[model samples]
Target: MTIIGWMIVFCEIAFWVVIVLGLMTRYIFKKKQLGIILLALTPLVDLTLLIAAGIDIYRGEVATTAHAIAAVYIGISIAYGKSMIEWADQRFQYYVTKQGEKPRKRYGIEYSKHYFKGWIRHFIAYIIGGGILVGLIFWIDDISRTQALSGVAKIWSIVLGIDLIISITYFIWPPKEKGISSGT
Candidate 1:
């Protein structure tokens, strides 16, 4: 395995560990700032691994299975990082600050509005993420542009389909009511 390959392994481990520890620190230990800092640093792990992979490819290494997997990882992280972080933040607030019994939706209207906004946000993210991946496809020498771009397109389409299903389900079976302000 290449150094980049090892870095990907380390990064994947560190990413999840950071999330777990961050949640533990914030929720269990009540160290919000420290936990948030750690959580915010999760992308840096991905970034480091990506840079290492780029360097490896630049040094004339062919794109291996490891590199392709790393590209997929990086692509997802880039595309969904904002939405994932938002979700975690809301979950933290709902459980800890609000002391809510659960994180499920309370009202239909407000929840619909929030869900629509999230869909829009994620749509924009997909576009930006796709563009970035296209750029990176150019940067990495051994990867096939057509294949990678096609893969990215498929990912975006899949995500879109899932989001649509969730939206329809939300319309059909809305959550029980709390207050308008508490839907987050």
Candidate 2:
């Protein structure tokens, strides 16, 4: 793997470690302020990856799949980080601290709405990440250097389209709730 690939892996690991530490501090140790501080630092990991990728490109290195993926990772982190943190916090609160109710499971129309909302988040991530790839392609100003990023963008675009189709199907055929009858 390239340096960018290693950096991406490190960033992912750092993000989760920071999240767990933040949650542990908040719930396990009862240090709310410190926990918030640690949680807020999650973005730093993304920033570090972004800077590393930028520096690599600035050094005249050709952009690789790893570099494109770094953009996607940063975009996803920015778009979903808060919700992910909330998700983890809810689980920690319910299972570890025992202070809140268990997270509720959605069904029927509610599940469809949830799925749709997730698709919207994915769209946002695509825009942000794709925007970065385009910007990098222009900045590099060489087709040979940016082919990997363009390929990633094309693949991601297809994935987004497929996701939209699946999400819409959730609305067309909403999931049935357990133990509920359709009045047949």
Candidate 3:
């Protein structure tokens, strides 16, 4: 892997590690702001990695394994960032403030609405992020460099397909009860 690719790999690993550890510290260690700060900074790592990758491609380096992994990491993050953060936040709230109370969302329009919003966000992210990847592919090609754009595209298509399936399933299986109005 190129230096850029290795950087991406390192960044991706660091991103998840930070988030997980941050959550543990925030909830388990009772350090809320510090943990949240660490979790929130994970995206900056992604941004730096992306800048490095972009610079590499701009300088005519062919994409490598690291690039491919980074592409998937970016795609997944774009699609799931909000939902994942919300999930973590809910868990944190339950443990930290709710005092062991189980978090619940009543099945209602609001329930469906929140998920539908998430679906739209994920779909839009796939489009924008996928376009960026494709643009990078073309850019690399235009400069006479051979990158694994096709392979990356294939992987993206699978991600899109999976997201679509998930959204559809969520829509079809709406909850039947009324959701509670907890100040989120």
Q: Please give, for residues 1-184, the per-residue lDDT of candidate 2 as tens digits.
A: 9999999999999999999999999889989999999999999999999999999999999999999999999889998999999999999999988889899989889999999999999999999999999999999999999999999999999999999999999999888889988778
The clash count of every prediction, one per candidate, is: 0, 0, 2
- Among residues 3 or more apart in sequence or in different chains, the pairs in candidate 1 whose N, CA or C atoms overlap within 3 Å are none
Query: Per-residue lDDT for 17-131 in model 3, tens only?
Result: 8877887788778998998888888778778877887877777677765665666567667677767776766776686556555777657466667776776776676675667
Residue 84 error for model 3, in Å? 1.5
Query: Candidate 1: minimum summed lDDT over ten consecutive residues — where?
Result: 141-150
Q: Which consecutive 10 residues in model 3 have the weakest lDDT in total?
A: 141-150
Off by over 4 Å in 2: 179-181
lDDT of 1: 0.70
Best by TM-score: 2
Q: Estimate TM-scores for all models.
A: 0.60, 0.97, 0.65
Put down candidate 1 lDDT per residue, 1-184, tens digits, no spaces. Answer: 7676688789878877888778778877899899989888988988897788677767766655566557667766766776676677667667766753556654776787677667776666666555655665676633453364457557777977899788777777666575435437
